[model samples]
Target: MRVEPAALEQAASKAGALENELRSVDVALHTTAAVRGLAGWETARRLEQVQSRLQDLVTGLANRLGGVSERLAATARNYRDSDEAVRRRFDDGR
Candidate 1:
């Protein structure tokens, strides 16, 4: 597969933005859960569970994006090295 650092970086940025949005929702959920729990609502626990699952999803996505970005960077560097090696061989008339 072709690798592009800029594209990967952009994706990482988008993931980061989503993470930020999730953070806001997470805070809201915490507040809501607290209020609901105090009122003895059974849904409060479910809301908390939802928040926790969202957190897990976001965390997993962030980790995957990070790994992808690192792999893209490594691929770019490998390609560069290969290109340089080929160029050197060509220039040496090998």
Candidate 2:
């Protein structure tokens, strides 16, 4: 079976974009008025943790998607090469 890289790449891109957006939120939440008291500090800490975990997850997924793209490209090339070989062997009577 053949797998398309475009779908995987799009998903990876969306995940990366979400991670970036979360990172921006993290940065925005790191200030004085945002983390002033106990509740605010706890909220900021939890947000930091969430951002870190999501960043790692999205980065890993993107890396895996990249690998899948490369593998699928190689698979396509190998299939094309094999098809050409068969065609040459049969059509050319060689």
Candidate 3:
């Protein structure tokens, strides 16, 4: 069967319009994807920085707590020794 020229022209115009629309959609999709990828990378970097900061803070707190514990232990030992000396002095007097 032979196709009419008018119908062929109409079909060709429709195909061209569809092709242009597809190209526009593809460009938009690529742009959106690139933006999303960039955002993801930035977010990951920020998270890493936060994690590093938190680790530093935790380490500092741990060091401070260790020093405090050591000081307290020394203070307790000194008090105990002083009490024992006082008790010995009282026993000798009696």
- Top-lDDT structure, candidate number: 1
Q: How would the candidate models be sorted by lDDT, starting from the highest?
A: 1, 2, 3
Residue pairs clashing, model 1: none
lDDT of 3 by residue, 1-94 (tens): 5434445445545544544443344333334445456576876566556656665665565555555545555555566677789999999999
TM-scores of the candidates in the order shown:
0.65, 0.56, 0.53
- Residue by residue across 9-92, what tens digits does model 1's lDDT show? 666566556655544555444456475655666667666667677778766766675666566656666767777899999999
Cα deviation at 42, candidate 3, in Å, is 1.2
- lDDT for model 1, please: 0.65
Off by over 4 Å in 2: 1-40, 92-94
Task: Return whichever of 2 and 3 wins on lDDT.
Answer: 2
lDDT of 2 by residue, 3-92 (tens): 545554555566556555544553334443444454556786876666667667756665665665566556656666777899998988
List ranges where model 1 is wrong by over 4 Å.
1-38
Task: Report clash pairs, candidate 3.
Answer: none
Deviation in Å, model 1, residue 93 alpha carbon: 1.9
lDDT values, one for every candidate: 0.65, 0.60, 0.55
On lDDT, the stronger of 1 and 2 is 1
- The TM-score of predicted model 3 comes to 0.53
Clashes per model (N, Cα, C within 3 A):
0, 0, 0
